[model samples]
Target: MGFRFRDVLTSWAVPSLADLLLAALVVRPYLLPGGLDELLSDASVGMHIRTGDLIRSAGSLPHTDPFSFALPGKEWFAWEWLTELSLSLLHSWFGLAAIALAAVVLMTATSALVLRNSLRRGESAFLGLLLVMVGFQTSMNHALARPHLITWLFLALSVTIVERERRGPWRGFWLLIPLAALWANLHGGFAILPVYLAVVCTGLGLEAIWNRTSWRGVWRMVACGLAVGAATVVNPYGIGLHQHLIEFVSSPWAIQMIEEYHPPSPSLGEPFYWFAALGALAGLTAVSALRRRGVSDALVCLFFLISACKSARHIPLFVIAVTPIVAGELRWLWDVARRHGGRRSLVAIVHDMDLGLRPQFLRHSSWLPSLFLLALAFRGPLGLPSTFPEKSFPVEMVERNSATLQAGRVFSTDAWGDYLIYSGYPRQRVFIDGLQDYFGPALGNDYLEMLSGGPRTEELFRHWKFDTALVPVKQPLSRWLKARPEWRVVAETPLAVLLVKEH
Candidate 1:
């Protein structure tokens, strides 16, 4: 097979404006309503700032969880320091909508940039970017204003930049230093950076030792990995940051207790996202091997693929890490195909297979982008009918309590923790939150028992010394409280029940 520069350009050129804009229409609304935006909405901003308060004040008091109560004198994760600081400052200066708007812009731009770069560098850019989009779709709902999103974008770009540079103008390892630094402060997921760097370095070392490659390239790769690892120490917690991440990961209770942390079970819920992820992984591996391409990088692709399939959060990383490799592989196949049959015959067969889309060079020149933006502006992120089920939260119940609740402390389920924090209860301390490990297994089990209609429900409630409790209407504690004269049901809704303890 022979490669032509024109064919490569056709495959790698930027997607047309029409295509880009249409993608925007598809992506914008999903970015808006509940997922991450809920964290920045009028409901969430106040509590987020309180988290910042704990940090800036250098105080032991926690803004969210009751587990922090026992660990009062100790350090907090501050995993979301950068985001909390940014949102805190933004809330003080302007408002939460500013942060939400910023999130939308950042997420939109990150998506566009990934697509643009993927299209600009490879012979099978369109298909590569499509796979990237599909890969991200599995984890798209969680892409909110949290620190993880910043790390997500940075990690995606870091992989792209390094992969693109493998054969291009190789820069110093210094660029990665800042990525690690910012990533460490942005989210604890920065721990994944060392794993990624190690993987790349290992691949490079294997190439040098076994494949008899240049030692120079191997040393540089190793140096870059080490430099990035050192840069993680630049954050406020210094080396202790890694300890936090290790402890968090080592916590087995979360996987056993937290739903998101649990492994995927197709029989339990939506199969589309998982299936989409699996399809992308299979497509990448088969197509890459078919082209007889970079065997070492194939291993890297496999690592991320297995990780992604095992946990839903890893889908975007797998997509970002492998998209360009797939493109390179497809490029090789295209070249081979052109040799067996002329370019004309090869193109015919490719199109017949519905293998890829043609580059819309004219898309960059159209007014279609304007229309797409207008549609986004009109439709907003909620997308009308709402993506998830409405009964997911007890909005009316929360609203009713919003007026009556003077109680400063409350107890609620871990799943509803983020929602309560976002519901403008900045001063309220939840019995639980997303930081699962901090609560310890015993308390977490007690929380479950309290909600499970167990006999120990009342005993656990008194043990926690909760001023009031907000639980599902279906909870045993709710029923017990409703029957007791000492506890009064202050508000009731199909989604949740609020009970106030009689003084």
Candidate 2:
């Protein structure tokens, strides 16, 4: 048989309507009124950029806290060094516009991979679209320009590969080795990779026992798990990264104090909405499990649902883990509905339209969807702001009062500290920032105490001997400092107030 154009087109997977919708949803955050820079809302991005600058300048990652005076020379792990380096390079070459565009591209690519995985599993186009829509809503809270975005993308890819391997030969298992290594350097989220592997392997082994079938891929899966575990330590910190990560995760401060670590609450409106939706979907899947369900799918969905409930940040992981399960369940539901009197329903309508499309048309038109996504990714850099949003950061205020800020030891909020470091580091080291691990339990508690104006707040002030403070105008600390006779307001803005100690 001779090679033909049709065969070539079919060999490369075509993007479906679901894939295009996912791409659009991923780019939605960047299309706000203020433009792409508005999507860079995470304060942590400032410190990430600063760290990237340091790595680029020194030609190596630093192992000591350099941005905060409170933890001067303290041992620190740049777990996100790779991500930081990328952010730094992009910001340096093309400014914040490039970073925003890069984030949109990464998120869109991640969504595309998830959509492709669902389609590859023989899920209906309607089911794929519904899953992507739900996944987007679930992950919107975490859609920021930070290293976590990198983790999300890698995790999606890793899960897709693992699922593929579970269904077929173990060819892609080896790829997880390097992916785990890269993940370790990019973010602490690398810890999830092993957990995912263990869960899948255990599910497969249990499934074999449940069905009284021979265990085919269990040994290979176990070996892949071992290899991935070994690959995780290939980062700069080696095993120390694991130690630090465990310490951070296990810390009471991290679990109780961090907003992201808290359980999903109704107080968080958008997040609560999606969390409830996922819970309802999980219930539906469980109720419909009798019709069609795999042990692995059920277990993974339960594990991720519990995780998402316990900590809001894990919502995206749950969204990713549950997509295929949701698609499978929805496919079953659609079939059931069609067999009943619901053939005239929306799902049936979509099913008819999808079935009517020719394979040749999809293969030949795949390039259009791919090109559309590429265009959406580039739209940010081409037409959006080149700098971070002024309202989000005290950019203009920092620049105008740079000399005054540099004149003294400054105490600033963790959120503001990142921006301060980004703009005025070396001359102005922070008391605290988003790198909670570097501060540890002791310093972290102290920072929180001072932030809440605890009884020891004065003691903290005396210990740090801070001569100036940059804080939000509406903060309690700012109000108290304004009332102190010993402190004078040197500069003030609607966003922040700069206070200096008076002689």
Taken over the whole model, the C-alpha lDDT of each candidate is 0.61, 0.77
Candidate maximizing lDDT: 2
**Candidate 1 RMSD to the real structure:** 6.2
Task: Give Cα distance to truth, residue 363, candidate 2, Å.
Answer: 6.7
Where does the lowest 10-residue lDDT sum fall in candidate 1? 381-390
Runs of candidate 2 exceeding 4 Å displacement: 1-19, 286-293, 341-349, 357-383
Once superposed on the true structure, which residue ranges of model 1 sit more than 4 Å away at CA?
1-49, 53-74, 92-96, 267-293, 346-392, 403-408, 422-426
C-alpha TM-score for every candidate: 0.79, 0.91
- Measured with C-alpha atoms, the lDDT of residue 211 in candidate 1 is 61
**Per-residue accuracy of model 2 over 205-238 as CA lDDT, tens digit each:** 8778877776778778888899999999998879
Q: For residues 1-503, could you state the per-residue lDDT of candidate 1 as single tens digits?
A: 24687655654464464356545644555565454335342223344555765556664434334233423544456556776777767655544445554555556545654554555544454465565556555555455555556766787777766665576447744587788888887777777777887777676676667667676865776787788889989876787778867877778887677555555556334434554655575566645653453445766677777776676666566666666566556566666776778757956566444334534521243244454445445444524221112356666676567644435467777656655665544444566666667677887887778777688877877777776778888776778778889888877777778888888
* TM-score attained by model 2: 0.91
Candidate 1 accuracy as TM-score: 0.79
Which numbered prediction scores highest in TM-score against the true structure?
A: 2
